[model samples]
Target: MPAASPQPRRPRAGSRRDEAARLAVLHAADDLLVEHGFGALTVEAIARRAGVAKQTIYRWWPSKVEILLDTLIEDSDKRLPVPTERPTAESIRGYLGDFARFLTDDPAGKVLLALIAEAQHDPHTAKSFHTRYLGPRRDQERDMLARAIDAGEVSPRLGLDATIDALVGPIVYCALTGSSIPRDLADTLAEGLLRPRSN
Candidate 1:
């Protein structure tokens, strides 16, 4: 009798994909974005580059934008962490400077701006971007500001939402306009927003 044909390997149980596969997908997405721009990126292409099944990509991400968003978040977390050990004002200032530099200097930053532009026209994209990325980041920043307020570092009268807008709005605006992002912009914003607690 002929030997039994080789059996195809089965996928791992449950929803947890292999870590290597996950990183491959994220890196593939970023590579494709750099090579072809967002308009040309697709799950098929990402799967091809990542050497994973297209279904695997779909199983992990609903869209290329989602993959890109995940990649951006991962890169940012590693490269642009907000300092937690310093004085509140110094921390905020350092974070703002880091954020501005990230936006202006990183490849992922260009993709982020593209996503933001796409979000303006695509409500689903907007919702996903906000729910998955922007919303969480905003919450983190807000908590930081709330702590500063409690400690009397930032003014109590400053609304967290407004404070957030004030802090990040300029960087986003300059990025959108293709204007020069002054290095001192972060310092100016931090100085304007952070104040000592008064008795």
Candidate 2:
């Protein structure tokens, strides 16, 4: 038998270089996502834009949608904090306002809207968005609200679940709907949910 073809020499250095190149590709895809919408994004375009081989992209992400979701998460992760400050009503207001500003600010808002729209048509993206992005946010806010309730600053029966929905729903709706959340909405929402129902 012909001597087993010399086992292909795997270029370890090339593998390391490829890893760096793959990261660059993901970054390029992220930039494209922010500039163009996800619907318009293409793997070929991303590879070209990143100055990497198309095979490099396929070597990592299984699909353009996966790449897009990864990019969105990476980008958002850099901007959003988990709100670990002491849970007071004032803290809640401040945190929520910061979050709202993030969602409404110039380019960030547009990217968020695009992600939401894309999530509507892509179940996997939607699931990931909720589990990774929206779910944690809601959980954070809920914990803050619960703390406020414990501190006697909010209604004991404010219905934590509903309160969370009320607080987050408007902001998300406005962001996705291309509308404003109103200057007073955050305060008003907090007050409405925090005020105790009289017996």
Candidate 3:
């Protein structure tokens, strides 16, 4: 039998080299964090280590904080999707499963945790963290919950923001507490949060 050809990679928006350069920058951030910690990882260092220009990193991200956020965001397909058609239970389970897996399996998660720790004392990074990383995902989850309300799966009385936080808080807890989220936690969150009359 002839040797089978390797499967082609999925098409991304940027040119192949463009994507490679971005990944190079992100991975360079990861490596710098590991070797020297966040205080030592600077944009210039990342650009030099990645063999890309400092301007190149700036073109895609505004700061080292965003570069780290983008690193995790890119690793997770940017963010979780709002469930429009899938059953609420299945949707939450699927989103959370992929999320936990990404955190557990990818170096991106390390950078994410580092950023979270960095954000604690730096107000500027905290703002970027919420705006770039937390805000969109929260909006997506809110949309999903709104759909669930319309479908009569979740209570109209449920506070959208807090509930969204409740569902997502555990994963964040794991990440901040120096642990990778286990996949089963996703199932638990989905089932518990969506359980009949539990809201």
Predicted model with the maximum TM-score:
1
lDDT accuracy of residue 189 in candidate 3: 79
Considering every candidate listed, which one attains the maximal lDDT?
Answer: 1
Candidate 3: regions farther than 4 A off = 1-23, 34-36, 54-62, 78-84, 155-157, 180-183, 197-199
Worst 10 residues of 1 by lDDT: 81-90
Give per-residue CA lDDT, model 2, range 150-173, as digits (tens).
666667344788877777679889
Q: What local lDDT score does residue 115 receive in model 2, on the 0 to 100 scale?
A: 65
lDDT for predicted candidate 1 compared with the true structure = 0.83
Better of 1 and 3 by TM-score: 1
lDDT of 3 at 92: 62
- CA lDDT of every candidate: 0.83, 0.71, 0.75
Could you give candidate 3's per-residue lDDT for residues 1-199 as a string of tens digits?
9999999988664424487798898889978887788888899999999999887777678888888887767765545444557346567668777666655556766677787788899999999888987787677777877777666665633477876777767987897776757768887877777664454
Each candidate structure's TM-score, on Cα atoms with residue i matched to residue i, is: 0.84, 0.75, 0.72
Compose the digit string of candidate 1's lDDT tens values, residues 1-199.
Answer: 9999999988676477889999999888888887887888889999999999998888888888889899988987788765555337778888899889888888778778878988999999899899988888887787787787777676734688988898899999999899989989999888877766666
Model 3 has an lDDT value of: 0.75
